[model samples]
Target: MNELPSRAHRPVRVLRVLASRHADSTRMVRPQDFDTELVAQAASVSDVDGHERYVPLCVDWRDARLLLSRWDDDCAMSDVPFLYQRQRRTATHLLAVPFEQLDAPGRAARMTPTFIFSIGRCGSTLLSRLLAAVGEQSVSEPDVLTSVAHFDDDAERAAAQGARERIVQSCVAAFEPACGPAPVIKLRARCNRAIDVFLNAMPHARYVFMCRDRDDWVRSSSRAFGDSGEALAELLKASVEAFDRMHAARVDPVLVWYEDLLADPVRALRRILLARDDLDARRAAVERALRTDAQEGSGLSRASLAMRTGDAGALAAFGARWREIRPERLLREHGLSRLR
Candidate 1:
């Protein structure tokens, strides 16, 4: 097991380690999960800007509140590729806000965010970094959003659909003030499951879909997450369903291919930015982003995966399985034929 960072408070560090060790557990985080002493010791704030500084660490739907932790000033949320990891290592002061408190009149008018959605192992993180480099405040995969996406109880999820939508809006709204007028947020790949929730919550927000070729995606996912072929197939099917839902909602999201991004990132950035000017700055930003590994130092980093050997047999088996189960018609219908 890896050693816990010394910077994190001892109780939070222990809890994080325990959570990581029990990664397969379906348990939801509750107020009781944290040390009461630590929670009491942490400073509390009621204003919106305070909430912005203390990003939503996780959502406690059963309790109808969010667990927020103050972010370190030294590292901007956009600069940290993995939000959860950073929080785990650095969070000290914690705050809990009720769902209703997040709601305010005219809150919706305050900011409009740009969302980057993707299949995992794609270049969405790189896109985020490039946007940040070009002076766009961007957050890559905040855990609060992931908690909502992976909310496991079917009955609770259905019952709290409206609340969930509000929670999504509130969280994004909290991020906007600190992130600038037009903030860019890159969500975890599995967030495709709750794309509808986001669409309904932030109707004015622009959406971008980042994707990779089918074979390469499977290989990358296997290498990174060790997901089986069947799992990858399910993810693809879910993405297809999400795309269909977006179209039904009358949203025409900008599509960005991972292959094209690698081939000519400046062109890709230009398309996503929808800007004809600033070519020189965009080129410099892309070049800087390309030199750095977007996910470096995190669990999903290539360096971490380098310790484990890739299985060729598993890759071949996944290929065969995917070819048999691929959503061929849906792929073509949704302009995702290249993925097939």
Candidate 2:
């Protein structure tokens, strides 16, 4: 039972909640509560984000449901429910799983050993798409690469295990022959660091390092994630450490630099084709990506010949930028940079 109040307050939605009755987990509250609350509210309201939210009697206990909101012009029973239909929310939280149970026991045979591991904010996504044109494979975002690979707590570990299994399922969907040509996985560089089981099973799998100019990367990063210098620095530092692992493993991977690709995308991609795959389909896809990516990355570089010529202001906007971290120098030093 829920109803809006006339307290001259900012707009907020109310949800009913309940804790799981089973006592396998000690924590009364769960992140799943947040997930369910959001889902249920979304069920009730059309513009959930625009409106502020509130839940009455939202204490640690049981019973929660989503309901539409209504305001009172002026009345005593404003917050009271029209019809009381409250019941408990979902009972199981993936967080309840133990750390030791994080890994999935499965016989996932290798179909491919190659992975496109981006050093955060690099053209990992673009490269992944380009690679998709080359081979039949599945693509994903920072997801498994971000939270799962670096699970700090038991809940995250459990989540990671589930995410890993889902990724495998994604691979199966991409190519019908599950273990035929092998599936190339694309993820952030740190994923390589945490995937012990994957590395052990697929030894031939090589990691492709996707790079971007430190400054341009920072610029793009700022647009995506604002004013978090400490977080950026920490992420960059972690990325460097992860790439370092690739070097220590003695894996001479395919390195695609951001600057080099932007400068002459076709030539750079042809070079990539020299080692990775010599098939015409792969080569053609790289060429197509070159044209498309050029349109997408038009003004990324200040020095690029193709900087927004007609719109002088856009070109000027990209002028004289530099990165706080000199990843190019570090790349060369760490042997993660490109070779002939």
Candidate achieving the largest TM-score: 1
lDDT of each: 0.71, 0.41
Q: What would the per-residue lDDT of candidate 1 be over residues 1-340, giving only the tens digit for each residue?
A: 1111123221111112222222222233334445523223222244334445677778766656667767755977889887766765566656666555564524754777888889878889888988888777899887788776876678646545557667777777677556875778898888899897788777788888888888888878887777787778778778877877777777678888888988987787788677447866567767878899888867767788787655456567766776887777778877898777
Count of clashes, each model: 0, 10
lDDT of 2 by residue, 205-296 (tens): 66666767655565555544342444444455556665666666666667678777657655655655556556554666667765564213
Query: Any runs in candidate 2 off by more than 4 Å, and if so which?
Result: 1-109, 142-147, 152-181, 189-201, 264-285, 293-332, 335-340
Q: How much does candidate 2 score in TM-score?
A: 0.49
Stretches of model 1 off by over 4 angstroms after superposition? 1-33, 36-52, 154-159, 311-313, 320-325
Error of 1 at 201 (Å): 0.6
